[model samples]
Target: MTTFGSQSDVIAFLSEPSAYGVSDLVKRIDTHAAIIFLAGDRAYKLKRAVRYPYLDFSSAEKRRLVCKAELALNRRTAPDLYLEVCSIGRLDDGSLALGQGSPVDWLIVMRRFAAKDLLDAMAREGRLEPKLLRELADGISRFHELAEIETHHDAVGRVRSVIEGNRVSMAKLPGMPLAACDRARLFTSSLVLLDQLTPLLARRGEAGLVRHCHGDLHLGNICMWQGKPVLFDCLEFDAGLATSDLLYDLAFLLMDLWQRGLRDEASLVFNRYCDRRAETDGLAAMPLFLSMRAAVRAHVEARGSDLQPDVKGRKDKLVTARRYLASAVGFLDRPEPRLLAVGGLSGSGKSTLAARLAPRIGTAPGVRLLRTDMLRKRLAGVDPEAHLPESAYTRETHDAVYAALLEEARKTLDAGWPVIVDAVFDFPATRAQVEALARAVAVPFSGLWLDAPRDLLHARVGTRRGDASDAGPAVVDKQLERDVGFLGDWQCVDARGDAQQTLEHAIAALGSECPIG
Candidate 1:
């Protein structure tokens, strides 16, 4: 190993990185994160002493902790790729040999795979498969489900802190594009939106989507190991940053694909995720998150552009800033107009019918379906799959939930987009409240009530899976005690006659005034 003491001495890294394989070094990269060197069939990762606000690997123990976090988190998302964390220290002779010897620094040793096979490379080489995207979604969803979620207060603090910290990144950085300056201004102007998002924190806390995620879930961080997708290099340093709303983490990739002009693939990935994990409270957070991620992208690209030598690279980076800005602005553009509310007692077929009828209505290319189970779970500040105590069903909590549903309905309809609100809307107050949102937006509001005898509703709830809702036979019985059936001049559909037949009726009801042109 060569002895180096200063920044210039680190020049050896550029040549040494490819010392593993010349071909690997010839490909690409320019981040102060880690350097890749191959030893046998394994890749040895050495962290840089860069201490950005969002992460810090500037010290020996800090690097070790971060490396361990990376190993543990990546193992969940890409189990085959992350082998183990190898502590690096000086040996008796004062040289580093990973864990074989001892004592200078810490390095994460990973199994080496072909660099050409990373998801980014595959996309560039026109070799990405549809199945690969689907698998990626599945892996991420499962990983998220298993990851630990922070408590509600910590979750909110972590997220807001990231935003505040990024401001520090903006100020201290030497190179920021003019467009980036404009973007910072735009976001500063939009800070009022934070008030809208602030109230949501309580609801989201209850729903419980705040988990430790693959902090850097971009295309470049994913690869195929043994013919399956493997995610790597997750952030390990900042628990606050990693512990956040799941949709905020997901928006990085979705925004990446959308920014890259790969809308079709983006849609495929998004649809696959929705189909598998099926959480809807994120719908409210996603657009807001998409904007933030795009803003981050603008800053990262613009700041990094300072290292480029050519004028074109500089202009291209500015263009990237514009692209991200446009994406953020697009969220507020004309949203489709229609309200589709799905109601029935728990297990009365509301979800199934709404899921089926959604595609037939809405503004064709897209329609948002907002579900109470997801929103309520998020509001509870707990994972959607975790069971809350029985006391969580207090009347106050139910009222807060309906208030959230009404809020979601208003925001969604105002966006000029068709939406499906999936909740019992059992209370007259709740139904009338949300219907008013549709009327205020001057949009036609439609409601579909899925009905079944109490017996079947009980059966469906007892057999549910991977869902965090508290509705069951007991909840249904309690509702029955309070008269939980449709009472106003609202559309009602029989859900007892087979879910398929019930779905058809709902679909027919929706198609009569399909939102899609």
Candidate 2:
């Protein structure tokens, strides 16, 4: 239906690789989208020049809508990368110049990023770092804080329209498995609960949680920009698709992480986001979203093989989509969690474990981590790294801060969310309080008391920097002398040697999302 390489000028530039050493510059397409090379620095995206029930990529106004949606969403974390949408023109001499006439076509120009820095490659080479995931978690939380929420659309109206459309697509597929039908139905029921949560969903939009978001987030769309994570290639063709739950938006990337088989890294990313956000109220939003993403993938595959007669060739992708849909259904079945808590003496890698173990649990998008030091500082109206006198650690301050942490945990868990509570819980009273709360809430809880040779702790603490926990080498002696009360509810994990090695052992104990007996 379309002719690529027909434009000789464009073809020549692509075929003759430039200085950045780009080679694979042909073209790629899905049912609704297509991408073409415009030099190594940018790519031009054009809608399939078709209209559908869910998306109208036909008229000029429709094309403009997509362009605006993509530009706004991508500006969230990668403003510098996505330049603009320019008008394409057919000149009098019959040539195409960007931004030239009455706009014969529309395109999104984005700065190109390297492929090898992707999480998939990083996972394959075993080069993913907890610190990087931690930073990425922080970055995403910041983006959510600034996003615009959906005000006009009810949760059911917004969500079901997309889900049900996928059901239609699944039905149209060559031979969708029976399991997929079951999964779509489960996802449908979950949307029923979502309808009840519409008011809250709208409140979140009012609170600015829903903004135009990078609609198609995956490892390939994210890159390390100046040692920071930058998201690009946002959904440019559909505002309705882009305006949805923050968790739903995040699920796409999380799904990509799992698909890449970086389960540990996925868990770390999940927990890290949760820790920073503590948006436990959004927990119920996960199933609805995760299912929708899986549905999207299902429809995507069905659409990909729409006219390709090789029915056998598409079976593998169909099966993959079917499994993902079932997984979405499984989350709706409410699998009970085995809560694994990461705790330790100051600077003993407890935070690291919490960050890494989260994405490994469910197909959940991101993790939530609760840091005592940061919470304590916030309670006292001070910056995380601000000097806290010994008075700040008094009995009254400790009680209030811990109470807040416990309350946060309740809120986080009640929302069906996972979190890493970063605290010493050194005193038996503190440890016991956490255990009792978890039992009262009926949430699975695990306590890991992280430790190191006292000398190692001393050395690490002596040189710690840029963190809020005020416990230094000077405080280590006081901590050591203090009664490390009640060791009953916790397991002691050695936090010695290199930090990464310590994390490897902890991840093994946590097991993969699909735990084997």
Candidate 3:
């Protein structure tokens, strides 16, 4: 293998398209640490000869090692994209060649795809469907399940490090957009949140929640490939950056969606992922995690402003950076916790309303939706979509499910997070119990009962697919015969209308009870 004395020689050699056995046309994209050369249908990534406080790729050996790491780590999520690491070398006649001669520098070869297929691009084009969002959440959940748990990494310590790093980075900015008072307030609030969540973070880490995950999980790092959302470009330079609590890893994507005004999509992803992982307890840490993620983006964007060559570009980036900082502060501002119950018979759209309202009910990342159907399924030790035997819905099982919901709600409320209970609540006793539970907790409580005609309920139930509720038309017919106690002070929402209209009616009924818009 040929060795080049300087990085310039290697760059000069790779600039020639003939070395890659492709046409003369070459497209190059440069980042802080790497230069990606796209030729034909393949791309070659070469680590730049650079050294930073967090990373070092100054030497050929270091570059080669990082290139290998990039290839290996990326293959875990995007096997089809990361091809292999090849060598860039000089020939005997002082010419450059790929995969031949003495190895001068390492290049990561990858199969290239269209940039417009990225999730961020889809979101910008308004092509981001709910189905795609759910699929993305599912894919991320599966990856987290299979990710290697890092036993040595302390979750709380990692979060502390991130907070400290953000502080240091923001302090280093030449002209920070935030006022001194605002900066101090945001920092203090963030620290307070971190202090409050230290115990939960430690417990989560001890429970093996700390895993080697996709550190950069924003929409830009994901793309629609092969009709599926494939995650790539993970943080391969530093293991410390990549290893953390799984929820914190997910916060990056959540923060991205929230900042982009995709609030519903962000909430949907959060709930779907939590449902798949059965990780509702982590919701308490979401505000801190999301704030940290936003702070990170803010500082990064602020630093990017300095890197821009033009005044207008720098000003625009500064504006974006300030907005991210504001979002970070907003995340830290906790809202008043309240308990909400949405009750109805099968196919009355109670669950749909719960799902839609949960994200907008309280603080960052929304409320914990405690659905009795899901609790019942969990109690039965069956899949959520699994149909339980008729015996499973007996009075004893029913009471057990309600008890479980109450217990969970208590814990969630005790943790200072809002909760939304979705259940049939057909019996007067059940309704009274929920109201009493909220009173006992001393939180503002609102109960919403959905009403729809029998025929409409039956039609809606008949179309149920892969949902947590096992209720079918037969179940709806039986529920029609049950006596639902007096409405009392609870609000009634017309469920026969479309979902958006129903949501509007629910919000209207909520009025001042719902503080978050």
Q: Number of the top candidate by TM-score?
A: 3
Tell me the lDDT of candidate 1.
0.67
lDDT value for candidate 2?
0.66
Evaluation by lDDT, superior candidate among 1 and 3: 3
**Residue range 376-478, candidate 3, lDDT tens digits:** 8878877667888787889899999999888888877877789898999989999999999989999989999999999999899899887888888888888
Off by over 4 Å in 3: 1-16, 174-182, 306-309, 376-397
Every model's TM-score: 0.63, 0.79, 0.91
Give the winner by lDDT: 1 or 2: 1
Q: 270-358, model 2: which lDDT tens digit per residue?
A: 65565566567776576567666766775675555544457675666566666666665654543343345577777686766665555
The lDDT values for all models are 0.67, 0.66, 0.84
Better of 1 and 3 by TM-score: 3
Ten consecutive residues with minimal summed lDDT in candidate 2? 1-10
Q: Which segments of candidate 2 are over 4 A away from where they belong? A: 1-32, 59-61, 117-127, 174-180, 183-185, 188-208, 305-316, 337-343, 347-349, 352-369, 377-395, 417-420, 443-452, 462-470, 486-517
Cα error, candidate 2, residue 256 (Å): 2.4
Model 3 compared with the native: what TM-score? Answer: 0.91
Clashing residue pairs in all predictions, respectively, total 28, 18, 5
Model 3 residue 270 lDDT?
82
